[model samples]
Structures are given as structure tokens and as C-alpha cells.
Target chain A: MNDAAGKNTIERAEPGEVGIVQPRDFVSTGEFVFESGQKLPGFTLRYETYGRLNPARDNAILICHALSGDHHSAGIHTLADRKPGWWNNLIGPGKAVDTNHWFVICSNCLGGCQGSTGPSTINPQTGRVFGMTFPFVTIRDMVRAQKRLIDSLGIESLYAVIGGSMGGMQVLQWGIEYPAFVRKLLPMATTARESAQGIGFNEVGRQAIMQDRDWNHGDYPKNGGPRVGLAIARMMAHITYVSDASMDRKFGRKRTAAESSTAAYTFDAQFEVESYLRYQGEAFINRFDANSYLYITRAIDHFDLAEAHGSLEKAFEKIEAETLVVGFTSDWLFPPEQNREIVLALLREGKRASYAEITTDLGHDSFLLESEELYEIVRGFLK
Target chain B: MNDAAGKNTIERAEPGEVGIVQPRDFVSTGEFVFESGQKLPGFTLRYETYGRLNPARDNAILICHALSGDHHSAGIHTLADRKPGWWNNLIGPGKAVDTNHWFVICSNCLGGCQGSTGPSTINPQTGRVFGMTFPFVTIRDMVRAQKRLIDSLGIESLYAVIGGSMGGMQVLQWGIEYPAFVRKLLPMATTARESAQGIGFNEVGRQAIMQDRDWNHGDYPKNGGPRVGLAIARMMAHITYVSDASMDRKFGRKRTAAESSTAAYTFDAQFEVESYLRYQGEAFINRFDANSYLYITRAIDHFDLAEAHGSLEKAFEKIEAETLVVGFTSDWLFPPEQNREIVLALLREGKRASYAEITTDLGHDSFLLESEELYEIVRGFLK
Candidate 1:
């Protein structure tokens, strides 16, 4: 998320006029007083909410998303001018998230491009896009910012916090860094600590992004952003989202066309698989800010609760939230064993926890896929 | 394999000397006359040998290699200064496939570089490399060339034919294509038919190659030969070479010095892995003709013995050799199940066969890695 607050102040209101809670236009500022007594500002958080907050404001739920997912988690515009949110399927009047029962709040995380400030955002002091100048943010810092947002909204504690992938990193951090504040924790397809292997794959993607000639040290946004690097990065990442078997079952020996099938002639994105990945990259560039990718991935890499607590068992000792962790068997990027590891450690620590390893071969993307089984688990657990 | 006779124009062999089987100067050709009456020409063959041929020439064994491997299966060569073949760890004096007991022959396949003719060879008729003009060759074609070579050398039945990967493909082909020629077979890390998954991975590699502008429709020899495309291809291949666990164990979440690793800026190679793969691509260009990659891989893709016969069982019915099949437990690219399928089909056909699945975390690369167990198996099987 970008630090939008440090810029020329926008209308500062409770945003409660339209059944809103802190509905400010465009920018919201946040600050951090580090454990070392170092105070840092030029921080901000841009957010959105669905449904009404009860007078008690104790019904708020912080909904988190995976990489590239935005704050559009629910609700279609009543005015017929806006599209339904990304998670509209899961969050609605009577949907699984049950907007009528909870004040659903979803925010574009820090270092994000949507409405929040990120690499593409301007550095107020330098009059340049933040690019690499944006201070490196930690997962703890992101959670701290969210906590401030909640505080500003007059909420004492979150009814629940939910997330997946990097968002799951935040949920875990919220439970550990502010245990009492989170009533329920939901993390899917994530690890307590980004394994060396996980980090290695991310490093390669980051390198591919930075190595692109257009990256120009992140200053390329003014010239149209580093699309090629980002695309290449996305292409590399696209593979991790799918299982080898899936790729074969779909595109096996199937040429995109007669011309592009052979090795000798013009390749021209002819394979069905190649075409699919390119589409993912292109669509991604339109909405995602490359700078945010660096920050968010960095934040994820920084998250090591086990290291922070000196051990996995110790980390779970601090997670007081009733936990519901989910994973897929075919999630190679974050295999279910990671969830089992966390669950086992929590059990060892006598922490309230629930773990379920569903059998699926959708790979890491299973969480995002259309799965009745996954939804049932989420609904039943939350209920 | 290629129809060596059609692929390269030999200036004419000077005849066999005491220690040499006739030297093929200028260009070497090995023709495999197909049953289809399609007489594609310009054949070439690159080969290397080890051990002493008995006076009766009845003690010869053939060593085959996988895709991306060549005739350099043994012996130290001053020109290339490469190691003594890939299986050198398992093949040496008094070792498995011992130099003392049997004469061994390994060739670069017809479409390969090394001393053989391929995309880089000058067409005697056109005085230019065939490039895309090179005809698609098959495993049976490769075997046919070997049969001619064997006939030329006055050897009737070979003591054994041993190989892994594509080499293993040849072994399978030899069992069915000419049942009387080979007396024994050792095929490792291979399947009777290249699976749909295998084809998909290969397609990714081929796409990477064809996407490069310098590839120039296989005419890019002067323009650096699709180095980037080939690198990308190699990168994809590298991922398939090891399991997730091996990657985690070897390079998870670790970063080297900025300039020394992929994390920093550099036009030159950064990260040991990058350097390693770059070296692999550069060295490959020097010794390999890209056209051969096209033709040989096409051959592998074209190979489906079950499709040729009515079924895999029918294909295996002709096998007269004592079979020793080996598979790696973690070789996801050609997993144990694939080899087991082949072994099972052979068993279903009521053939004499032995199988072993070596436990290793090395993934598909186990065939190349040093394994004392493999040595013992080969030595004992031969005895």
C-alpha cells in the first residue's frame, strides 16, 4: 500500500454519513513507532468495506486476499455504475461470508497499486514515483498499519481476520503480533516461515523483474511501468499455480495451431499453454503495480514467526485466535504439510486450532478455483 | 536418432585400421531405410567407443544416452576437455560395463553435433545446413542405423545394449525393432512412449527456442543461436530435473552477494546457478547443432511403440534379451510409475525382465549422478 496520507490532505471525515466508517477519498495516512523507538511516517492505507457496522462495531471482519487480489471482495454497486467485487461469490447479503451478519472490510494491502500507494505512487518529498525509494516494509509493519486503521474506525478488535498466501502471512502476523485483537484466524496455502525453497522461487521471479531493461531501478513507471519484466515474472510465476498433470491434461501435444506446432517455424505463442500464461501476465499488468509486487513479496519474505518467537512452538503460544488453517494436497508451492506442521506445533502448544488437508490436484491455485468442498469447509468452520 | 545416411555426406571411409573402426572424415552418414519407402537423405552419425572388442566381436555392448546427451559416454577427449562421458562413474576398468570384458559403442545420434551431422552440416547438394529442412527422424530410424553399423563391423548379436533417457528409448526400440540383434537391455529413467506430460515439457522448451528472434527459423547460427531462448528452455528443463525437496534443500530462500547472486544488477551472469546454466547453453551451442535438437526431439516425440504395434504388450512380445530396467523414485519427469508401466506391460506379455527403482531425491538427474548401487547392478547383470 502507498503512503497516501503524507500527501496534501484530502477530505478528512468519519465517512459515516452513508452508513460508512472512515470513508475518506483516495488516501489515508498511517505511521509506525518501531520497537527501536524509531518513528516513521509517510505511510497510508486505502480501504473499502461492505455492509453496515453495528453500533458496537464489534462485527468487523478483515478479509485478506492472495497475491494480485484486490479490495473488491464483495458487493455490486447499487448505482449500477461499478462492477461486483472480486469475492462477490463468497461475500454478499446471504453469501458464505454473510454481509448481513458481519461488517466485511477488505483493504488493498500496503505497497499495492489499486488505490493504495506502492512503487508506482509518488514520493512526496522527491516528486518521483516511490520506486525503490519506498522504505522496505515488513509484515509486522503492514499489520501495524491495519491495526491503526481499525483504531481510527473506533473498532476495539476484529471479529475475525482472514487471508491467503501473503494475506495469510498477515493473518498469522496479526495473531502473533496482536493476539488478543483477532478473534478468529484463517490462513490458507501459506507457511509460517517462507521456506528457503519458497524464497528461492520468489527470488528468481524478483530477479527476472529487476533484470528487465525497462525496470530502470523502478523508475520505469513514469514511462509505462516495467511490463516486460513484470510479464516475464508473471510467466515464471504462472507455472507454480498449476500442477504438471493439469498442464498435460489440458494442453498435451495440442498445438495452438498447425503453424506454431513444429519447432522449426515461427513459435508466436502458438501453444495453448503459452497463450494462457501470456494472458495471465497481460491481465496482471493492468491492475497490479510492479512496485507493490516488490514490497508485498518482501513483506512475505520478512515474515518468519518461528524466527521471531525463537521457535515454531513458541510462535503458536502467542496465537490466541481460534485458528482454522486450510491447505490442498496438490499445493506444491505451499504443500499441505506446511499447514500440518503449524497445526501440529499449535497442538503441541495446546492452542485452539483446526487443520484440514483436502485432497485436490489443482496445485497452489486450488484455493482460488471453484471448489464446493473448499467453500463448505470455510462456511462450516466460520459458523 | 536420424537417418545418418541421408543426413550427412561422408567423403568416404579410409577403411578400418588396427585401433579404429573406419574414420568418417568431412561428414558421416548412417542411413535407416524405413518401411514406408521414404528415403530421406543427408544422414550423419557422431560416435565414441570404449574397451577392447574380443577377436570374435561377440562381447560388444552398446551404451545409449538420454536427450541432451551425446556420443561422449566414455573416454577422455583432449579437444573438448570434458569429463569421460556422463556415466563415467559407473563405467570404467573392472567396473560396471567393465572395459576389460566388453567392447562398448555410444554414438551422438544422427541429428546430434559432436562429430555427427545435424542442423549444422553442409548439404552436399546445397552447400548449406539443412536447418528446418532436416527430416523428422524416429527411434526406429536410430536403431536401423545402428544395425547397419553393426553389420558393417561384422558383429552379429550384441552382448548387451544399455542406456538411460533417450538412450533407454533406443534400448526399447532395439528390443522390438531387431529382436535378434541385442542379447541384453538396461533401460533407466525412460518410458516406452513419451508421456503426454513429457511432451508438454518438451513443447515448452521448443517454444522457448522458437520464440527467440535469433533462432531465425533455425538459421541463426551466425546470430548467437537463440541463447536466451535456449537459456529459458534450459531453465524450464532444470526445474524438471530436481524435486521440490531437492530444490529446497539445495537453494531454498538463500541469496548470494548482490552482484554475485541474481538479486543484484548485472548484464553478465549472476548467481552460481545462472552462471552454471549459461555455461551449459554456451558450451552446448559450440558442440551441438540446433537442427539436431529439432530432429532428435521430434524423433522422441514421434516414438510410440504401442501405437506402432496394437499395444505395449504386443510391442514387448518380440523382446528376446534379458532385461534390466531401472527407474528413479523421484524422477517426476519420468517417474517410477512410467518405467513400471513399461515393466508391467512386458510382464503382462510374459517376457523375462528384471526391474529396480532406486531411491533418490535427485529427481530425473539421478541417472547422471554417481550411484554405487547402479554400478553394482550393471556389473552383476552383465555377469
Candidate 2:
């Protein structure tokens, strides 16, 4: 493995293995101002890079992650890890993203929990965790931060920018905010703006967290957050990630293996789906910060690209990048019709935009799954 | 209006108005045993009737309420009331369910909160609220309880039984368990059994309520239950009640009037849909009992007609009633395909069953709404 000198270098993995890449922190000296008039004195972006940046720096690609995603996008953090990164399926040496040819960078977005400066991070001014005091972040604010990171890397422009769901919102924002800097854009399973149903679901999740007494109005003691409320929030969200068909196929009407044929009729997880959701919720609580979930989901709910630019057509008018917008048939959260709206707007602006509605039972999360069709589409578009 | 003598008279409305039919309680002398082996010493069923039962007593039509419904199926309880009943549009004098032609009965289900012996009711054994101690109720048990009430009214082999959602489950159970009693069955916007997605959503809502510290393990002080948790649960359930199309048409991305163009980015109801849901949740907390909500939803989750009888076809084998199953096109909670499953099973048993898939954007709640097509179908079927 090639080790280039940087701020700090951690252990390297074996050659040919898209293994652990240590994340490095980039602290901005200037204040990070949010659209809401709130500002952070200074902020740090935790990011990881894969592959080598060519001398020309023209091979760089930026990967924006969805809600709850971190900087770890292509490899395991350690050799003992049972699974690699969230997008490891498509972002390896010979994978769809093909890190062998593309120098990929993935950063924990602003107001995220994994490593980026977020609600869980310490406020430089107060010497305490920002908590709810952290200024609410918008997708545009996140893109702006990423722009700073890219500029610092000496990469004038990115070969391509890719993401799905909330990450896709960032990708769209990038195209509008820095049209000349992004060569191509791949925004999958996202809308130009959050829909009413989408906002409603997010609001319920927020309410679930805020209602938790342990949440303490977003000022829970350090490492002591609203686990139960956050778990409930995750459970609610997990249901939306997959389609009804997928749930039926995966769990169906089957009861938990431990549950007897005779109904217990108790408030236990009797159905297999219920058990699965509980497991998912519990697992999420271990990794995600409750306050971060609140901020990020709010960011997503408030995302309306067209609202900022006056109209969708106006939002696309300045987009100079070639775009490939993908949507899944079963994605109720970000339905294919909503994705189509984005492409239609791009087409109306006479921009180089193509649309693909993939038939997948995986729902909105199909963008992160291993699908040959999705792979081919991404490969063709990027090529 | 005709004054029917009962133990108590509440109020009366203007002449020619099907208004203010006071609910009468029928206390079963024997123990009410649940499918889970738990029992209530004696239970009361609060019921309201519209129109007069003829000499033959065969003109009675039973209307089962959905999850949040009560005995108030038609007309206002008092003159000051701005609204009539939940199904007022369809149950008035010359309406589809036509009170002028049929003697209609609507009862609060066995586990319902509104004027029924549910978890909120006092337990004879402990002299305290049943709370979580309430016996687990099933759709079959609810139908059985209704049978006792109908028998008390001297109604044998009633004209018809109709319901939607949980109420529809009761209608199905009535046809299967008391085949000889129900002359016709009208089950709308329901399934033969709860689907995995349905169970998942219900489980999440249950978890939301149970996780609240204020829940006090389902034994919160009188009128001091988990309001926030219950409200969250209501908000979640409300999402499933309507279609994405309906939400978009009703609220879309429109923000609340108070929210400024520039995002305030606060943890408040920014979107109109969010405000609407918050209102729905708050309003529900005023009328619903948390523990009752738990018990009733569990009853709905446990409802599987086919599971009781080896197969769905077997469930319909002994049914003597002419069945008409109606499903809304946009009901993802209980899709048209699920309703068709019931009709298919009935047909497979050589039962006289018809199916109507109404095209509506109202989703699962369409059964309760005023639809011309639905009215025509109900009218023709009852005729």
C-alpha cells in the first residue's frame, strides 16, 4: 500500500485490498456560517481517501453519503471487521466505482455523527458539546464544506460526484453550487425537494426523539443520549428503507422462531419482521448519535433545491455537469416519479441529463445494493 | 325523531335528523374469555342504533368501527357539536348505508376506549383500571361480543355486517365464526390477515408508546398516560391511513404559514403536513386511551382469519353470508391485492363473494370517506 505523508498516518492494509483507510481531520480556520444565521467558530471535516491522486488531480471523485453514513465508504476500519464500508460493494478495486482508476474521497457530512463536527462535537466557544446548540445544517451548507475540503486538496474539479437519498441531495447541491467544478453527477433515489409524506415521516421520527425524556432537549449528558427514542426512530426509518414487497419476501407473516404457534398476544416481538426491526433499532443506537439524527433528518426535511433557486428549471440552468439520475420502482420515500421530476427539470434546462428508473424490490436503498443493472448503469455513465 | 326507551337518555336532535342516539351498555353476565386464555369477569359493550328494527328483526345492520372509531357512527351527539359522526356521510337518512331502510347498529369494540370496557375501564378483580391487565382481545372475540349484544336486541340472522380496517377484520371474523347469524358481509379496506408491513408499522407504534417513560409500564395515573408517546403513535398511524398522493394534494411541500421562506431550522412544525399531523396527534390524545390503543392495535395485529381455520379457503367454507369485499387502489397498508386475496379465497370455497376495487386517492381511509362509486356499490350490494 502506498502511504503518502499527511497530517497523521494510521496502519495500512495489504496491497490490492480496498481495506482500512485512516480518516484525517481538516479544520477550517474561518467561521462556518449556516443558512439559519447560526455559525460555528471553526469546524473540522473528517474524511478518508482511497486510491492515488494522479499528478494532474483530474481522477478525483467525491462520494456523498446518505443519512447515518460515515466517511468509511469503501473499506473496513480494521482487519477484524466482519463487513467493509457501506458502499464497499460498489467502491473497490474492480467494483463499479473502480477505486483503482478513480481517487475517491468520502467525508462525514456536517451535522453528522461518525467523525465530522456535529451536535456531538465540542463547541470551540463553550468547551462543551454543541448538542442542540449546533446550528441546523442544510444540504447546501454541507456541499459548501465539501467544496472547502476539495479546494484544500488542490483538486480544481471532480471527475464525478455520486450519492443516494440525502446524499443525493448533496450531489444535486454540488452541481448547482459548483457547476464548473463537477464534471458529472450521479444522484440516485432522491427528490429535488422533500415531499409532504417524506416530511411527515421525518417529523414523527424527530418527535419520537424529542419526546424522550432522556433526550433532555438535545442536551443529554455526554455519551448518554436517548437510546430508546433513537431506537424507535431508527425502527420507523428502517421500514421506509425497504419496500413492502421486500418485507413480505424477507419476513412475510412468519412469526419469530421463538414464538409459539398459539398466539402469546403479548407486546412482544412475535412477528419475524418485528424482531428484525428491533434488532435494527438496537444496532443503530450503538452507532448513531440521537442528537445527530435529529439535526440530519431536519436538514433532509428542509431540503428544497428549487425553493432556493426560485424554480427547478432555474436550479438546473446553471448545472454544467453531465447528469445521470437513477430511481427505483419500489422507493416510496423518494419515488421514481420524484426523481423523474429532477431529470425533467434538467431536460427543460437543456442540460445533459439522463434518467433511469430501475425495477428493484429493494426500495430507496437499491442505490446502495449490489445490482448488475445498477452497476452497468453507473459504469456506463461514469465511463 | 323516534324516542327509544333505554336506561338513560342523553339528548335528542331536530325532527327528521338521525342525530343523538344515546349509547346503551349491554353487560354480559358470563366471563368474556379471550383467545389468549385471559378473561374479563363481565364486560360491557356500548352500542348505538339508528332507525327502527322491524317486527321480523331481520332489518338490523351491524357497523363495526375501525381502530379509533366508536359507537358514534352517525349524527351529532348534541346540537352544539359542529361535526356529526365518523361515517355520517354514508349512514344518514338517505345515505348509502341508508338508515331509512335498515336498522343500523354501531358498537365500540371489546378493546376500544370510547364508552367500552377496554384497558381504561375499571377491573372488577383489582378495583383498578385494567390498563395492561386487560385481557388480550382478538377480532373473533370482538365479533363474539357483538353477537351477545345482537342477541340481547333479539336480532337473529341480521341483514348485514360491514366494517373497514380493524372493523373489517371484525366483519370477516363475524362471517367465519357466526356464519348463520350474518346474512351479508361487507369488508372494506382490509385483509384476510395483517401483512408483514402492517405488523411492522403497528409494532413500531407500540414500541413508541411503550418506550415512553411517562407510560409508567402501561399503568400511568388516571388521565395521565403517555400523551407524547401516544401522539407519536397516532402520527405514525395517520401516515398509513392516507396515500402519498393524498398527502401531496393536501399539503405538498407547503410550509406552515408561520415558517419564513428562509429556514428557521428549529425543531418545530415547519411544513403544513407536519402541522396537520401534530394536530391529528394532539387531537387523538384527547379522546384515546394509551393502554386501550395498545390492546386494540394488538388485536388488529393478531387478526388472521386463515390462521384460525387451516387455510383461507377453509375460513370461508362454512360462511353463509353473501360477501362483498371492497379495496381502495391507493391503500398501501392493506392494498387492493390483499382484499382480492380474501375474495379469491371465498370464491375458491364456492362462496357467493364479489370484489370491488375502487379507484381512489384517499388510501385506506377511503372506506370512511364519501365516494360516489363506493356508495353505488354498497347500495347495489345491500339492495
Candidate 3:
């Protein structure tokens, strides 16, 4: 059952390395009901774990992921894998979330494509890919699914539940749903609710995907579907992930060497930023399912703590976890104000919550990018 | 040659109405060269004029247009017309532009589609639509062509040149290209150069159009071509035209009455903002040519005065006209800082220039929207 056991080839673990890890699946045959009142007969959650559980089983920490992220987060998938997991910089043997002292777990979100039962998964009843047939999911639904996974692992309580962006949404939901089950919550680069601007961006991305003829009403085979449209969406959304200042510093009017020499204008990517965006879009289509993108983004758009609980303050009334919300200075998507709103709401409820504003030019994706300040904050908050 | 003369059927002009106006086309048979070094054998400019030019022809005011704008600056096309010109509010009799005293002239830009010689026009050499074959255009090329039309009108100097957004680009270009030919300039809601973020947004829009199957490589039949893609582009761009605060105020999680009552999930536009964007996208496809959209946006992407000249100061060094650059407070697309930079450079050059910033939640399109502050700034600058 422990898939990561035999994969550790290193005789001596590197100081910050979690070493090679493998994803494992946990299947539950019990009926799963979504927050939208839709139900599935069963579900599978693919996850990766680091370190080991103590006798008391109370030292577990849950790692939730943002949109487009999944199970593998901290270690190399294989010894030959050139790139480590998405959050390898922070969660390791001696890293911020120190696997040495705490057992860490991260799962592919319920409606995710990375070995999780998502839109691309075959529907058991019809023997066909779920596609749009999959029931609508929400931040609460994602948190509940993770709760089941944690319960199955025999963990009675989580030492901490940490995430950023959509993961941050789940983090907030976890605090509300299982108030007494989680000790600490670290939600970063996210909002208590998706703003109109955020919803507008998501809507544009959804339109781009749906506009493609190849989408075939979300019935296309898993191997192919709306590549162009998905790429367009990704290209546009990627722009929102970084700050204007960061983009200018990185690519300011710099053209591809071949493009700069040509006087004739073509529709091809000319600016370095254009080329980078194109690459991002193309790379996204290779791993992401279009229907899952639609579902996840919709869930994000529908996420409003205030609307769900009647008000922002009421949304956090039951939260017992010590919360630390992180906001980035340049993250216009979920600006500092949005992040602070969560802490303010929690404080208003007389809960143990605080706010941290990181000054950075990385924009919304600041949580994923490496930073000493973020690392320190996460480390101290977890402690 | 005076097309607007017989169109005004109103016995008495309304207070601010310029009344009925007809678009006139001026055909030129002489070679017209583009900044890219390509040449057009001849071209036609569709234009409209309000009021009468004095015998000296010194009271004429040239009105340049933004992207997607045309010659119709004031008045209705006919007595039966339901809508007046795009800028009817600001460019009518006794309005800020004051058609009664200034002999206002507006034109469909050189690379525009509204009755102008553009991609949709039949190419003299090929006897077919130019499409992608249309010569690359620039802000300089547009100013040069407008100069020809102005000279043909027997006007030696313009009392003023006024425009916003892309039109503002033209106003700046006019000051540089014809230093002694324009007495005053009003450029608003524009930038001296497109920012990386601006370029990114434009690139996304372009990608959407090009990705459409019906785009037919910009060679599609005039009646049909990438309508969905064009609409998608318009929807995405519409978001940039407005600010976050404005969008929230206009559409804060408000759904269509029918959508709010439904429980099932679908890709249909549920939010009012989504419906509004879809309408904008649909409306744009009916009036705009995909090829023209490509060409005009390309022209905008290439406009960088600092790059063309050694520096912004150098770009303004030759300008002789008194200038006023206006920026809106909430225009994140081309923020006030960018607008202020133009005047800063002009001041560094010891040029007759100043800047005005109007506080508003209307975003980048504030210049087009009715604002007493903008109107006052324009009127005072003109005086």
C-alpha cells in the first residue's frame, strides 16, 4: 500500500530532499455526495505521502493544491525525473514543512486529471468517460473528499492544512467544515471569495475552450479535445498569473532572434512574452483536461464564503484552526485586500487568525514561486 | 463632395446635435507607402465633416479614431436612424469638440474597415480582397494618410487634432509628423508605447481569432470568417476595457433570472456579465472584419515612440502643438501613470504640454463615456 517505500534509492537523504516518491490511490466505494446535491457511487483519490505517521496518528499535515496542481508536490517522481515536485522547495526532510517531524500528504483534487476520478475518468455506469456528465464540484466538496482520505489513513486530526489559490479556498473550507480536526491553516495567495474580476477572467477562459469546434460538447476522446481553444485560454490566463512589472522585467519587447530580423509581420509569436505564453498554453494542453478546467474554474467562480454562509464574518465563526493568510503585493487577481479580508473576518469572529502581506512582483503565482520570505512565514506558521 | 449637406432634414438643430451626416470617400490614385516599406498604388478614405470650414480653412479640427472607431464621430446617418455616431456626445454642436465653430472632420482610419480602403477592400493589383496581403500599418502610416486627406481639403493647418486610445496614438503621431501643421492637440486614455501587459492582452485576442477554423488564414469570404473566434476575442477584450470596481458594481454575482433558479451545471453564460460580454462579442462580429482586427491590433502593438525615436523626449522634441494628455484614474489597461509619462517627456523637451487625470470607475473606456471632467478638460484645452 505504501508506494513510496521501494522508490527511495538514496542511501543518505539529502538535507532538503524528500527523495523519490510514488503516487498511491485510495478507493472508497461509499456514495459520495457533492455540495451541489449531486452524487457519485464511488471515487478514487490519488495521493503522495512523505515521512511516516507516529503512533498517535495526530502528526499528519494535509497539502492542498491550487488549480492545475495535483498529487505529486514535493519529490521527484523518479530518480531520472529532471524536475522535482511543484513544492519541493518547501516540503522536504529539513525544509519548511519538515517531513522529519511530520507526516505530509497531498492528493490530486477530486475533479482533477492526475490519476483522480475527474471528467476524463470512465463513468462506471455507462462505461464511458464522465466528461460533462460528472457532477458539479465545489471547494466544500474538495475539502470533504480530502477529509475522507485523511480518515481512511486513520489520522484523527491534522497538525496543519496548508494550500494556496484554489487550494487556499479548500484550506478555508477545511477550517469551517472540520473546525476541531485541523490545528493550523496556512492559506496563501487567495481570497475568501472570487472577485468579479476573477470571475470575469475565468469566464473568458471558459469561453475560449467552449468556442473550439473540437470540444464536441465535451464528448471528445481523452487523447484529443479543443487543443487550440485550451491553449488560447491558458495563454490568456497565464498573463493574469504574473505581475505587469514582472512581465516587463522578464520580457519587455524582447523578440525571438529570428523574429527581430524579419521586417515582414506574421501572426506568429513575436514578443518574448508572446512566445512564453504560447509555450505555457501548449504545455498545459498536454496534461490538463478541458472539461476538468471548465468544472474547476466554475467551482472557483461559484466560491463565495460570504454568499455561502450569509456573510464573511459568519463564514469563519466556527473555525478553530490557527489561521495565517498570506497576500502578495502584486497579485492583482486576488490582491492583498482580498487575502486580508479572510483574516479580518476570522479576527472579527474572535478566532485565532493573522495576516501576512508579502511584497513581491510575482503576482498571483507568488505562492508557487520560491521566496525566502514565504518559506519563513510557512515555516513559522507551521511551528 | 459635401455628402452631409442634404442629409440634415431637421428644421431646427437640437441643442447638442450635429444632426444628420453622410460619410464621404476620397479616392487617391497616387502611390501610398507604408512604414514597413510596402506601397499601395492607391487608397480611399471614408470621412465625415460637420459645420462649415471658413474661407481661410484655418478653423478645421481633425478628429482621429480609436481602434474599432470610424468616420462617424457626430450626428445620425439618417432621420430614421436609431443611433447617432460613436462620439455624438462629445463632438456635436456646442459640445466639447464644438462642431459649430471648429469644422470637425473624422475619418475611417487607413487600416480600418468602415468604408475605408482596408483588408476588406478589393486590392487593385489582385482584384480580390487584400486579407493578409494588406501592407503592414503603423501609427506613422495612419498619420501620413490622414495628412493626405487633410491637404486635399485645401486645409494648410489644423486648429487641433483630438482623439483617445488608438486615436490618441494618432494625435501624438500628428504632433511629431506635422509639427507646424497642428496648433493644438488632445490625446486621452492612451500611452506613448504599449506595455508588456497590453501586448499580452492583444496577443491573446489575436490568438483567439487566428485559432478559429473559419479564419481560413485570413482569406475567408467577406460574409463569413471566424465569427466565434472574433466574438471570443471581443469578449475577452471587453473585460480589459472596464475596471474591476466598475465590473463589480455593474455585475456583482448577479445571474440571469433563469440561470439562478437552475441546479444543473452548463457552459452557458449564467452571470449577467457573461451575457453582456457575449452580446459585445456577437455585435462586434457583425461590423468588424477579422483581417482588419488583425491589422489594426498589429499596428497598435508596434507603436512605441521611445523605441522609434531614441527616447520619449526625443519623440516629443519636434512637436510644436499645444498639448493636453488626459488619463482616467481607474484605467488599468493604460493607467494614468503611462498617460502622465507622455507629458513628462514633453515637459522634458520644453514643449507646450500638460496632463489631466479624471477620477472615475469607468476604466480605459472612460474617455469614450460621458464625463463632465473630461469634457471640461477638452474645452479648456481647446480654448
TM values, all candidates: 0.81, 0.96, 0.96
Off by over 4 Å in 3: A1-12, B1-12
> B105 in model 1: Cα distance from truth in Å?
1.8
Best by lDDT: 3
In each prediction, how many residue pairs overlap at the backbone (N, C-alpha, C within less than 3 A)? 23, 0, 0
CAPRI-style quality class for the chain A–B interface of candidate 2? high
| Superior by lDDT: candidate 2 or candidate 3 | 3
The CA lDDT at B167 in model 3 is 96
TM-score per candidate for chain A alone:
0.87, 0.96, 0.96
List the RMSD of every prediction in angstroms: 7.0, 2.3, 2.1
Candidate 3 per-residue lDDT, tens place, A1-383, comes to 22232233223467679887778888988999998788999899998888877777878889999888998888887677898888988888878888887789999999999988899999989999999889998989888998988888878999999998999999999999999999999999998888777888888889888879899889997779999989998988998889788988999888877799886666788888888888999999999999999999998988999988999999898998999999999898888988998998898899999999999988999999889999899888887
DockQ of 1: 0.23
After the best TM-score superposition of candidate 3, give how far the Cα of residue B361 lies from its true spot, in angstroms: 2.3
Give per-residue CA lDDT, model 2, range A130-205, as digits (tens): 8988888989999999888888887889999999999899999999999999999999999999988998999998
Q: Looking at model 1, what is the TM-score of chain A?
A: 0.87
Task: Estimate, for each residue in A1-383, the C-alpha lDDT of model 1 and write its tens digit.
Answer: 11231121122221221121232333445455543243446456677776657777778788887777776665443434255456666665555666666677777766677766566777777787878766666677677767777776667888889887777888888888888898998888888877654554554456545544466777774547667556655666777777767776776545566545454323345456666776777787777777678767666665677867899899878778898888888787788888788888888999998897778877887776667787787777677
Candidate 1 chain A lDDT trough over 10 residues, lowest sum: A5-14
Give TM-score, chain B, model 2: 0.96
